[model samples]
Target chain A: MSAMGDSGYRSLVDPEGGIVDRSIFVDDQIFNDEQEAVFTRAWLFVAHETQIPNPGDFFVSRMGTESVIVSRDRESKIHVFLNSCRHRGMKVCRYDEGNTTSFTCPYHAWQYGSDGRLLGVPQNLTLYPDLDKSQWPLVEVPQMENYKGSIWATWDADAPPFLDYLGDAKLHLDLTLDGRDGSEGGSEIIAGVHKWIIPCNWKFPAENFLGDTYHNISHESVDLIGIGPSAAAGQKGRRDADIAEYQHVWAAFEGGHGVHSALRPAELGYQPTFRDHPAVEEYYRKCFESREKRLGDAARLVPFVGTLFPNTSYHGGQPRALCVWHPHGPTSTEVWRFFLVDADAPDEVKELLRKYYMRYSGPAGMTEQDDMENWNYATAGSMGPVARRHPFNYQQSMHASSWEGPVAGQVSTQISEQNPRRYYEAWAAYMDGQSWDQIYSLGQQARGNGR
Target chain B: MNQLPRTSAFFALQAEVADVLSTEAHLLDDRQYNEWLDFLAEDIVYFVPMQRNVEVGTHAERETTREGKDMHWFEDDKWTLTKRVEQILTGVHWAEEPYSRVTHLTTNTQIVTAEPSVDDATIVEARSRFIVYQNRVEYEEYYFVGKRTDTLRRVDTEIGWELVRRDVTLDQNVLLAKNLTVFL
Candidate 1:
């Protein structure tokens, strides 16, 4: 970790155990290194299997600075290809999402099959008769796999297996994906992928998603504009109530992923009224059971686990999502999210899920907009050279961040900076060029018997 | 193709609509959000209908709902618009801060029809196409294409017709900018 500081990147450290210092969220050189060392090697989420349901269905996604096309082939197999065409470096597919048997690059009419195999190249029959077609196929991602129905691809061959990389975060991922499988298989993604770009470092949203319950009190408490039913109802009177609820997960997983479950304490024992539908009830029951089984008899039950690692973060069975944290430059990041629904579920269930996701996490959602405002103002204000000189502090409750294994106790408390500390800890490892194996070993040591 | 000369009543109605829209755009561009609220009619209805193309067979006989050609984008109302505006004034608005510069050039104003034999009150609709050139501090320019429909009435001696309704139908399905925070 000290070596990372030697690389001209200043490390903010606190001996008391909380976040000592972190400028990665605002630095330019660190952002450039992240594109190479982190994004280029880390497995990035592509799309869900349900998104490209049939042959020829395709959706474009970005992993760090590079763009890739994730599509399903004639065999219904998912393929990840660099969006650049083999002939002239033009984008083979222009549409954000569509169904196409073969993509013909507009630049030179070179066509490629859904499987990423080069199908046709204009004038190749005569001009490059000796050229091998097999060597010119779309550049396939080095590693691609599906965790449940969610798709992920990596550019680095040295990346670990998808499941192994997920580690403890895998349980939460399974809860989000497989938990729905308990009743009628599972759900599917609807027609649209809920996306919007917020003007902040992608890490800002990532950190907020991972842990930042303080914002609901700090920002939303003042501006009571209603974006949804819950928010509207909460703000209907003289003294408006903050429309955010929390249940925070206080743990870290292997692969550098971590979780935080935050929910309003008042909502405890608030059972769903319409559980008569067997399928719906079963799905909800499994969700509850999964949390209980995983958390055991902790005093407070966490409804979801916020997994923050690599480049993506989200919770299992939860309505919120945080992805990309995609960098626009040194100080700005474009954040995109998918508030998905299980396709196999009923329309009413989908509607409920949509409203839930839309209410708190979507672009226009209440909590989400509140977050964007603060992030925008903070990042925008921190841009001035004078402001950059100020070392942003995170030294709060570090020594008190006690844990039994990976799960930190008293994490749901609003003032805990433990999550940010954990985040920077893993970040420090990556900045120091620690191999994945070595990092995992260190993470296990950090978590003790949790692994 | 022969039509009567545009009348004084027509010009008055058109003038009202143009004034309302320009004022609205100014409020948005200048971020003078609080003042923008007074222009909207309390019962005003704002809708950007999602247009979709239905198959010719399903929508035969030259009906409007044909696939690949027809679509709807946003169908909103006064309530929704008010809420949208409120979010901005509250400082929680993320879409428009350091606001995107926008200039609404509304032209080709025409009075399509005027209800005849009506009392002092007259019902007339104005049609105009506008091009909104907008950009943030360091982003690419976004071209917003659409036609604005304003229902206006000439009241007493006001400088412009009093706007009762405004509807904008954008041609593009996907919003090019990061977010749509201003009126076109």
Candidate 2:
């Protein structure tokens, strides 16, 4: 294996650090290299277990560039397999989602069971009497794991265990995925997936969700329109006094994962925060009590948004939205948005949350409309020769961070680029063709150096 | 589910209904959204249900239930529709700042049910197929094809019809457009 040269790769990111070359967004060679070095080896999110609740239930999902079927077998074991035929490499199952006992290839009529075992092939005895049927099965994803109902898989057989891969990010993920006490069923993805295309590199959205509070200014129009209290207040011009009062925290974890969150003050009286609906408010109050008992002081903080390394992201609070930025190529991405709600919540609250989700974060949503336009233009501008030569700055609040909080990872204020700096550092590590062990160690060393 | 025969009276009513639909389409395609809002009844429920593929024995009941068990793309009442129109009309909506050029092609109009002797004598349920072509910026173009079920009520003799309810079901499981800023 040819490792990336220090000069060639290190030049793409600033040698002194906290700056990134624009070429990474539009370079064809770098994009192809990422498919092999990052996507194939990384643990990527596939589907939630609740999405395929029963035996034979399946959902077609994409991991990087390869399409896979996330399904449950007769014995209720979840499996992920490449949705390709063994004979000639055609997609065996074409629908986005469905339940079936077997998948039959359209072109050659080759059949495979829900367990991905080859059940039949056309003219098996006539064409080749000695051909072994046991040797042919749909290519299985090498490793799979379920954590709090969210399913994840990796093509690399040697990838670390999912929990270890999560590291301290597991604490924040549990806040959204694990719900309240004995109601361990947690949150379930609502029935539909909102998918749409964007003419931008996948990293723009992924990095934004990871930590890009600076772009909140782009959402000023949403505030002018008076959509929500948070939108109306505007994140700009907040004094250090306000930051301390709100208890705003931006924490970056190991393995490039991080969260930016702040407590929505009670005096703000945000409607979706349960101030408008008493019943829903009462339910959440108890839920928060249970969470406080479980997570201690950390439960008091409300997570606004966070990213899980390479692609998947989640936004907590009302009308919760989880997203996966599926990379199409160097210049485009296919965004899959899933809305989630607590399974135990009342039907009316669920309906209210669904409507709120459609209005705020769906493809045609008010707030997201602003984000898409910015990303689309930003990605397009990178194609210019002069533009690609310059590097983007990520030096905001670089030296201002402390580990004093009870929360895990390197902590900073809500408005800072330290999180994105950490993200690109990880990206550079992967691009350097470092092994997972090396990458893990790099994170530790960076943590020791502090933000 | 009574299918009305193609009598002269039915033919006249069908043409009038088609004209009403055409006028509404023209208003939307021309971006006369406030005028388009006037064509809707005060109690209108405009909904677009989410589509899904399921097994042979299973039914994707996104439209059948009212308890919000199933997800939908849009479930707007008159007030919500008005709010959406207000949002679009605001000059700051970046997604629509350039303003997409839209063309709505509606065809295959049929009256599914008509009861001429009732109190609301001219009330009818109609269905139509629509294909909306939307172009934004210099390079992006989107084609959205869907079938719409509508409830039309003849409000007065001078004004032909007003849409009281509409349910649009799109064919694509995953919408390929950047944003669904245009109406179906």
Candidate 3:
């Protein structure tokens, strides 16, 4: 609606006043512009390498609205390529996931190698003799990285490297992907993926995951009826009561990433989780003791939830998983959730965790069911012209956040909107076509959006 | 499925199975959640698995996620299922707080197999199709179409049969609906 680029973004998003215009969630033009501005430049999380362990294994994944094939080539090198055939626009491979040496487009007999090389035409010599196979390989992403067994790619060649894009956010994410015993990265996806659709803006879930402690009321229902692992043992809460002993930290990073982690007051002790099964209880107790011993005080920062800038989100503890809010439209999101567990954990530990993961996440999940309902209607409520006139408030504990706080970036002890405010500030920078220098070096004083 | 012997007792057993399904649909649609719980046995296992797209021949083995071994939409037992009902009845489960108007349209009833004989069946394998339509909060609506394979146990109570196990094959790879707050 408004002119885009440099000046237009400031009108919609004002991180200083701690206010954001509602159009960002419902407008079609702005949503369309985001595909090129935000989605293309950001390092998006594709399939984890563990999903396709051997050669020729492929998984269909999404970057934004477009589909991409994440395949392990014949040489076992991972590649993220556009799923479309170079000749026509048909999808090269239709299956969600499988092992294939090469993909054959159903529309035409055009075959491609797992490395995305255009291998054979229907009639290579006769049909088009001048067509060079080297010229028409599937459009590959310009930049790619495998950080902690997870794959991330970006279309922008000028974009910063994946770790630099992650910056301070990597430490928070390692707690999710690393093994419970303080191993660097031993987590792997479970056998299946929970994919579903939700009628809401992508940012609704993204912002929710980025340290929104204010919306705990959204999950009051699941909280009332305990669905935690220890719920069967007369616990009346949505998660383990062990978190109650620690101080909650809402950590924000300059690269638009933020996390809700916890800090123990003093020395850590074994927290009684998985009380229903003694084997599971014992397994976790050993993990906790070893993690405490290995990482020393570093293990005190237990991860709760986090969002990596533009789209990816993760639930580190409880329902351990990663979610990518793939945008379908301004008001529709195709959510893909991948459950994670230690690849070498005991069968009992993996079994109980998988069962608890299903009960806590996805469309049918008890805790996440209410979340979808809230996000769905919230998108609808913001669609009308009458609602767009008034701006949404983000000024919770405006100056209460500290830049020199313990964890990373800006830190807030009690519940605060400091993370979301800074998150939007960085989002607006991207929408304005800011350079990587501006996006990563957003050094501000109390989130006032000052240079 | 082998052709069932069309005896008079078999016909009578068919009627009893159909009534059990039809009655349970009414109890759920009428917002009588507490009463609907009566239809389930104490050890009922309700599972809804996520579907995946694989090669045709592998459909039987790898199409749907495993019941106890993989991630699924639901792998709930009696305790977890009861908690779901309790959440809706809490009047604060915002997903169903105002309560969506849902209808369980079940059809294609077939009695696959029965224990002992159809004449004196204690446990029966029943198959049917379901199209659960839910309309909520003004303009929100979704159609959940699926197949249900249920194991029903004959009881001496007024309800006639209780559902011991229900395996729902939702005809969706990626679930089209947002939240499955309403039962399928």
Q: Highest lDDT: which candidate?
A: 3
TM-score of chain A of each: 0.82, 0.91, 0.97
- lDDT agreement with native, every candidate: 0.59, 0.76, 0.88
A220-337 in candidate 2: lDDT tens per residue? 5554554431322332111111223566778887677878877635443222334445675566667666766775555556656788878989886544767999888898888888
Instruction: Give Cα distance to truth, residue B82, candidate 2, Å.
Output: 2.1
| Regions of model 3 farther than 4 Å from truth | A444-451
**C-alpha lDDT of candidate 1 relative to the true structure:** 0.59
CA lDDT for candidate 3? 0.88
DockQ-wise, the better of 1 and 2 is 2
Candidate 1 lDDT over residue span A1-451, tens digit each? 3324575332554323443433566667777788877787777887878767888888887888777899899998898999998777998876666677888888888889999888887898788889888889988988999766778888888888888777666655554555343332254554444444556666776776565655556444224665443333343311112223444446555555666554435445433322324465555556555545554444133335364466677744445343556666666666556545555556666654554454345444444555665676677777777876675666655444444533433242435556665666666666667788875675556546332
Best by DockQ: 3
Ranking by TM-score: 3, 2, 1
Model 1 chain B scores worst on lDDT over the 10 consecutive residues at B63-72
Top model number, TM-score: 3
Task: Write candidate 3's Cα lDDT for A159-208 as tens digits.
Answer: 88888888888898999999988878999998889899999999999999
